[model samples]
Each structure stands twice: as C-alpha cells, then as structure tokens.
Target: MAEGLRTAYQLEEDDIATILPEEEDKFNGEEFNKQFLQFDRDRIQKINQKGKEKFEQGYSKAKKEVLDQLETEARERFGVEDDELRGIDLIDHIVEINSKKSKADPTKLTEEQIKSHPSVIKLLNEKEKSFKTREEELKTEYDTKLNNFQKERTFSAVEKKALAIFDKMNPVLSSDPERAANQKSILINDLKGLDYQEDGDTYIPLQEGKRLEDPHGNGVSFEKLVQSRAARYFDFKKAEERDTPPAGGGDGGATGFPKTEAEYAKIVNDQNIPLEERLEIKKKWNEAKSQS
Candidate 1:
C-alpha cells in the first residue's frame, strides 16, 4: 500500500460494500433504448390525435355556421316562410313561385285577387281616402273664390253707375279736381246710409227691407232718388250758376257775409274761398236771415 492509503485489510466491511457494486447490479444499453423509443412514439401519437380531434370539431362548427347563414339569406331573398323546406328544395320552390308570377297576366286578375295584393291594396286605400278629400277641398276653395269675385264685380259695376249719377247731381265736381274725390266719397257714404246695395248691374235702394218706389208705384231709378235727396246733403251747384261773379269778388262785400240768396250762392260755390270761411259765412247768413 502507498503511504496514507487505506488497504482492504485495514477498511471496515460496511465501507467496502458501499464503494463497490455487486455482480448482479449493472447497466443495459438495449433496454434503455427500447423504453426511450416507446415513450417518444406514445407522446407523438397522442399529440397527433389531439390535433385531429380539434380540427374535426372546428370544421364541423364552421360548416354548420356557414349553412345557417346561407339559409337565412335565401329565405330573406325569396320571402319564403316554409320551415319544412330547406337548402336546394327551398330555393327550387322560390324559383317556381317567381316563374308563376312572371308568367301570369296582371290584367287577368279578378277584383278580389287584385284587392288581396298587399301593394295594390295599399295604393288603392291611399287614393280612395286622399284623392276624394283633396278634390272636395279644392272644389270648395274654387267656389268660394268664384263667389267673392262675382260679388266684387257686381259691387264695382254698381259703384260705377252710382258715381255717374252723382256726377250728374253735382256737375261742379268735374271742374274742381281737388275737391271732387272728397265730395264724391262723402256722397257715396250718404248713399250707403240709405241702404244702397248692388243687385246684378243695378243699384237698389232699400227702405224697411223693400225697394224704394215712386208715387206712381214704379221702381225709382237710383239717379232720380239720389237727385231728389241731393239738396238735403249739400248746396252744391247742379249746374254752373248763370253768369255768377267769380268767388271773393264783391259777393260778400268787405265783411264777406252774403246779404242775398245770389250772394250766398256765389260765396258757397266759390272754390277760391276756404271751406271753413264759406261754412262760417253760411252760418252767419242763416242767423241774420232768421232774425229778419
């Protein structure tokens, strides 16, 4: 033995047994290779099987979803509600119905068949309700307008005739352009106060809801009636005074107060004299005449 090295003779039995192996205990290369190869094969097989199962499951689910989508689209396009018919059979039924509709003549359909159609019924209902109502409204509107227009025309014709009569009643209006319109307006208002209204092309004067008549029981012309009432309304000249002196010309003298009937006429008829001053002269002349 080398120095400091323990020999077999000097070591304990337990220590020697611990360091050495028995003859029956040893490694085997062939058995290890067989077990490792089997383990690898089993693992690979399990992974492949699991992948196949996942693929099958996914394929079936996707296929079912596609089929369901196709059925929904087909039903909407063909407006089909037959739950029993599906896929190609449903498509064929939709095509056959379309073909029948295309081949049928719309004009040959009976009234009941036409009424049963949804779109046709909807259109007919709308027209029946709206067209008649709209036509009535338009007719009423047209009638009202026509009535108003006729009334306006009659009124205008009567006014024109009345104005012509009034012009004859006050001939001075033709010469006095400035006061003619105002005076005519006043006269027309007075005529209206006598219950004047238009009857066709003529003017009617009503008294107590009856047409005014002359003593002869004849219908009194508006001209004659207005002429009879003219004196009460105004002291206007029916015709220019025969050779009367011009206004403000020695008619009233220095005081401008008329002393005689002729002087009063000249003063009142004078357009040159202001209306207020003429009215005042008339009032004073009347007072003086009453006292006399």
Candidate 2:
C-alpha cells in the first residue's frame, strides 16, 4: 500500500512526515487552493488598510503639535494674532499651518503667501530695535569705564613712543640675538646726539642733542650711548622680517608669490636693500618683472 501511495503521489521521504491527512485536504483540489488564496488576499488587504489609517492619524497629530508650537513662539516674540495667520496657497497647507503664525488673512491669500504678515513682521522688527538699543547702551557704559582706566594709567609721549619701539624690537631680539645686537649698534650710532631718560627699566627718547648728566659721567661718549638705544629699534624691524618670511619661491621654486609691479615694490621695500641696489634694481626691473 505504501508503494502504491508513493507511486501515485510521487512524495519523497522528507515530504511524507509533513503531509498529514488533514493538511493534504487543503492542497488536494483546485477549489481548496482558490479558497486559501482568497483568504490570504483578505488578510493582506486588512493589514494595509489598518497601517494607512494609523499613519494618517499620526501625521495629523504631529501637524497639530507643530502648529501649536509655532503659534506660541510667534505670539511671544512678535505678538502675532490668530486672525493675522493666513494659510499659504502654493506651499503645502500642512507645512504652512505648522509654521510660525503671522498677522495675515489666511482665506484671502493668493499664490505664495508671505510667511510673516506685515504687521507681525513690523512688531518683530521693533523688538529687535529695542534689543539693539540696549546693547549699544551697555557698550557705551563699558567704553566709558575703559577710557577712565586708560586716563588713570597714562604714559608721556616720549615714553609711549619708546615703548612702541621696544615692542617692535622685542620680537627681533627674541628671534636672532646676533641680528638684534647689530641693529642696536647701528641705532645707537644714528641717535648719538639725542638726549634720553630712563623711566623704570626703559630708555625714553628725548629731544635731539639735549645732554643730561649721566651718574657715571667720566666723559661719557654721547654717540656711543645713543647708538645703544638705536640698536633696539633696528632689532625690532629685523624681527618683523623674520616673523613674515617671503611667501613662495623657496628652494623648491613654488612661485606662489604675487607676480606684479605693485607686489614687487612691496617685496623690495620690505627687504630694506640699500638705495644704490634699489636704483640698480629699477634698471632691470621691467625685464625681470612678473606679469600680473
């Protein structure tokens, strides 16, 4: 009998365990197959309908929440009213309704309704103006305090200029001790005739040729003394050069530097080459000049 059943059904050994008599009833005929297919279709349709309904409900709730938040914010910030809010035409009503409420008529608006109505926008502008005015007042008060502080701690013109010179020189002095020393020597030689005073630790520049008695006045050389001060000024200039090195044209020939007459002038001026060399440079300048 088993051999006959196997021959008729063409079932394998694995299939035999799952093919129960009751289970076989559903697949035995075309009518049962049709009924099973219809049941599956009905189940799928029901599930889809339920999912769509839930999605629509959630979307509506979210939209309402967003609108509520926008309305609250607008009212607080700009004093916008409900009557001022008009529904935008071209924009999605859901998104527009969710946006900040403005003082405009929703019903009468045509294509592309203004996000914020004129009245609502004007109110917001007024609020911004008030904030800016307050900020300016605070700033003025702070500036006044700063000015008073500066006046209380003031330096003489010569002292101030000396400090400025020292600041300029400091960077150079820090970078190359040798170059700074050389510059200091040259400056002292140049300013030999100037009279200077020491305020605290700093030497202040004074009127030229005004001799003040030095405590160690054993025939002090005025030229040597002024030269020492000049060195500081020269060192500062050198330091500036070191800090901002020539851009481009390194050993690799990058050519990133500007190629123009104006740019050339800037480079030459910065290098501090002697006047004779500068004159010679102008002779060959056009030929060697880079095109802009």
Candidate 3:
C-alpha cells in the first residue's frame, strides 16, 4: 500500500511537470510578486527622500547660523534696510558714503546716505538696467555661498590644545588679521583629524589622517578634521557675464537690437526685414516704449 501511494505521488509530480507553462493555474503569483517588489522599491525611495530632507534641514540650520551673523552685522553696523533701499545699489550707496566719512573702516554705512549718494541717485534713475545687473551679481554671490555640506566636529579642549601645538609648529602665520584667519582655518582642519597618544607630558598624534580604532579614543573622524573643498557649482554663470561683449558689441555696431525709440520705430515700419524678426522688434519696441 505504501509502495502504491509512493507510485501515485510520483505520477502526480510527473503530470504536473508535463503540463504546459502557459496552462499552469498560478494564483496571480506574477502580479503579486511584481506588486511586492514595487512596494519595497517605493518604501526605499521614500526613505531616501526623507534622508535627503533631514540632511538639508541640518545644513540649512548651520548656514542660517552663519548668515544670521552677517545679517546682524549688516543691520546693526550698516543701517541698510528701509522702504526704498534694496539690493546691491543700496550696498554700493552705503559703501560710498562710508568711504567718504569714516577714517578706519570704509564699509560702515548709515541710513541718510541712501538718498544722498551720487551713485544711489544714478541707480534710481536707471532702475531697470541696475536692477538686472545687480540681480546677476546676487546670483553669483548665492552660488559661492553653497558650502558646509558636512560640518566639522569641534571640542573646546581639542581646539585649545591644537592651537597651542599649532602656534609652535608655525609661529609666523598671524602677522596680519587675514593671514591669521587663514592659518587658523588650516590648523583647525589638521588638528581635528588627529588621533593622539600621551607620552608622559606631551600629546603625540598617531597618524595624519586615520582615527584611532578604540571607541574610548580622543580622536576626531578623518572627515570631521578637514574643511570641505567643494568647487562652486555654476561658477561659469558669472564668468559668462565677464566674457560677454558690451551691449551692441564693444565698438559702436549694430547689436541687432534697436537702441533708440526712433531706431525701433524705423525698424518696425521697414518691410525689408524678415517678418519674424520684425515682429520681435515691434513687440520689444512697444514694451520698451510703455516702460519708458
């Protein structure tokens, strides 16, 4: 009976194997599998998105700390913001006023100069051109501000000790404020990345780059030690502006753009120009006329 049962089971398996793949009565297995894979993929995608958001939030906070300081400096020292004053024209006005009045520093500005500066008056007169030009400069400044991706881990004890050691190794760095700042920046990056071992009275670094293996070690991570050196994204944007020829090509020439209202009027009325280019010129002329 057992042998007969075994033979019957074997024959059933053989019959199942003999059945055509197309005829198999699968319980929506292909659909279920596809859905299962897609579900996990969607979850992973969401997780990645969340991670990016978290990183951006942290970075933004750090950058805001840096920016708030600059804004405070601008507001308290410069007195720049008002109803009419805005953008680089305002800054230029401030700078010019500061330059004329102050003895020590030339950048400290006051609110009164916003209206009085010759450059400021000129900017207000040519608002459109100045607005467009300064807007481009602002874009360049914003692009350069894209740094601080992964911030350094700094401890007071480490910094104090590092500074002591750093001054001994390089004593001539702090002759001027700018050189001192650059020196400090370079030293802090190097000191933070070192893993140290004590020898009686002195601290000695294990290596230049690697952190100590022990969990209890007093070493900063290699990444935390160095300042990020990312290249400016879209640096070519401002460079492109510098590379651009002056309006109507350096020397006096036909810029293919009508400079005067009379020129625009003549070009728009002329039938010799192509219909598309003429239409463009007419539309531009009408817009310029309205603005004027």
Which one is best on lDDT?
Answer: 1
Which stretches in model 1 have alpha-carbon errors above 4 Å? 1-111, 116-123, 171-176, 189-221, 224-235, 238-292
Cα displacement (Å) at residue 9, model 2? 27
Measure candidate 1: CA RMSD. Answer: 52.7
Summarize candidate 1's per-residue lDDT along 12-80 as a digit string, tens digits. Answer: 444334333232123233653464345445644765577557655655555555556556656776687
Question: Clashes in model 1: which pairs?
Answer: none
Per-prediction TM-score to the true structure, in the order listed: 0.34, 0.22, 0.22
List lDDT for all candidates, in order. Answer: 0.56, 0.44, 0.46
Best first by lDDT, ranked = 1, 3, 2
Regions of candidate 2 where Cα sits further than 4 Å from its true position: 1-27, 79-116, 119-292
Worst 10 residues of 2 by lDDT: 249-258
Q: What is the lDDT of residue 161 in candidate 2?
A: 47
Candidate 1 vs candidate 2: the TM-score winner is: 1
